[model samples]
Target: MSDAYNSSWFAEKLTDRSIRGIALETSALIRAGALPVGAKLPPIRDLAFSLGVSPATISEAWSELRRQKIITGRGRNGTWVSGDSFVAKPERLASVGHYGAGVLDLTMAVPDRALLPALGNALVHAVSTEKLNSYERSRILPELEADVRRTWPYEAEAFLATNGGYNAVYTLIHALVPPGAAVAIEEPTGMRLLDILEDHGARIVPVVCDSDGPLPASLRQAMLSKPVAFIFQPRLHSVTGQTVATRRMAELAEELRDTDVLIIEDDGLADISDAPRQSLGRVFPDRVIHILSYSKTLGPDLRLAVLSSTRLIIEQIQSYRSFSSGWTSRILQGAAAWLLRDETTAEGLKEARRLYQARRDNLVRALAERDVIVPSGGGLCAWVPVASEPFALVTLAARGIAVHPGKKFAVQPTHHLRVATSNLTDRYEEVANAIALAASGG
Candidate 1:
């Protein structure tokens, strides 16, 4: 939190580019860990004078860095490095367990191959027709933004796209929840989401969930600490697949009424889920931040998502993005727009939804018959409760079936395993047998 930007580093690293060149070079340095944490940046005016650029250029660069959460400007106190927060968190494959050759890995909760549209074709179609231009002209591709607004489930005043679902969630958190402030989140939520919140230095107040999603009582308890924000995974609640019931959504919205808590809704699975999409956003229009991600529909590689809410919050996130990451990849945005809007990916979308629902329903039914309880929250993953989670994981692993332990998803220790059904085709019988055997110890 100390001001640490020095002019000497920029002087040595400046390239042929102007103010942006300076910013980009500094960002590179930050990424390389050359600019240590707590390092104070040179005063904006000082840096501008040193670089022989207008103060406005330096101001623009600084705005970008601040929006990205790479640096924090404290006005008279001075600007300091906050780059450690942006350092990419290495994927925790070790905790989740890596797969060996020939192992049936169903660990990641992602859409099946049947689900992803012909991305290559869509990208080609988009690139061939659309004129390439600088994304700097607009933070969002006009067509994609329109499509997002067109399909948005809630009555949002405005919309903004982020890098992905996580980034959208991160932007909401970074924008509203200050460091050390307690923020309420679902107990058994997305594992990566928990890591993202922790990384941003927020106090996680866990609100335990049932098959119906977060209980009203637990949420009421969480609100007492006067949390700055609350993140809810309304539909396809990760390991559990628990969507908040319509009645519960109303009740929760009522409780949040008049409260300052910003509701961050991660509705990334709406397209693929069999369950009807319901959101608290409609009830609490002013308080809700709705996030929709296309990775589950298109493919994870696309990494495109949008955040919708009131204009103020959208503008704040937009402002941060404008200065920091600038805009989402135009090529990716264009391809997504073409795929979703055009006739090309329409059949693919329907097939993906139908096939995933079938797989999830069958898995849930099969597990229920085996006395292993897990409800299909209309998602790709089923949460199967086991007598002994460790033994079941070992047994299943021995059977060459790799699954993610449910403990990873929960704030509390869990006796359940999240079974991913993305690749369960002919192996449904075999996989079901392994899971039943693992759970029953028979």
Candidate 2:
């Protein structure tokens, strides 16, 4: 409630009244020490009147600052400058993978390196690609597109290759969604997805999910906010490992029948999952954007993922890409194409699928023996419920085993642990015993 830094001062200093401009200028003032920490901001209506702008504009600017942790408080409580730092990071992704030595890290849900197919022959085959190192902005290599089309869930109007799965998602959201636009996503989704949405200043409306998939009623309720897009993992959810059932997909399609919200299906597991891929693209081809990533099945170093959608949407995403990394590497695309068609690669993937399934089943069986039952869904991790997230994390850390807390992947209250099983090949019984004790809060 300082009179020195009041509405009149902000109005005089803020030449640009747009949302971004207001947030940026206010942040600068805070960093310059003009607006010291604990300085209360003028109410939205008063600031709008002083600047000759709408109250909503000022409100949005404040929201952006809040997301960055620069300011705190809202409504009748009054807003105050909390911090000077403006850089917002991926909180969940940054917090994991920092354990000390001698700790079994089960936090990263990545594929086992030993199981990945050899890339020597594919690299040699890529040397013969049709267009080698041209500066042209090709959406995708012809050979790669043709190979992917064979197993695509449905006929898409166009396709674009990206650097990776998360890159494809980040680009699409930045290109299509404006700041503060509502986005509907599954509740217990990948932590990185949440980070991307928050970085874009999106208003996330979480759709709750059951074992089958995102519940129709929850999706129907989220639609009330008119989200611009709905993003969900179509096969083998990275955290939960559950596949959306075919019946659930039909019901979801029915729920979205009348709306124009873009359906973004992220098939990150690719062919690694034994379950067949499913998508809403079949029902609404014009409105669905499906992305298939090869990082899990193929090597992560390749960094290739393909997205298919209507020509207009694809073109928009491509246009955005022109600003940075105009196109994915043709050599990598060629290599992926060769591997997809290679019989040896196919056999390796089949064997990898079998091995991953066995590893996951082993953990599930071990946990069950300790009276802790969890679904053996298809993915690299297993979601085991716990009595308390804090207690479970502390107990597991004491045992030199590190696992991700369930709250990291949830927008709502949840008590569980996402334990990686892809590399849990040898210590199944020992790890399961630790998990069992953690679940019982011992």
* Top model number, TM-score: 2
The parts of candidate 1 lying over 4 Å away from their true place are 1-94, 128-131, 135-137
Clashing pairs in 1: 3-40, 4-39, 4-40, 5-40, 5-41, 5-42, 64-323, 241-377
Worst 10 residues of 2 by lDDT: 84-93
Query: Which candidate number maximizes lDDT?
Result: 2
Residue-by-residue lDDT tens digits, candidate 1, 123-203: 885675344655563556778877777767777777776788988887777777776688899888888788777666677
Judged by whole-model lDDT over C-alpha atoms, candidate 2 comes out at: 0.92
TM-score of 1: 0.76
Q: How would you encode candidate 2's per-residue C-alpha lDDT over 285-338 as one tens digit per residue? A: 999999999999989999999999999999999999999999999999999999
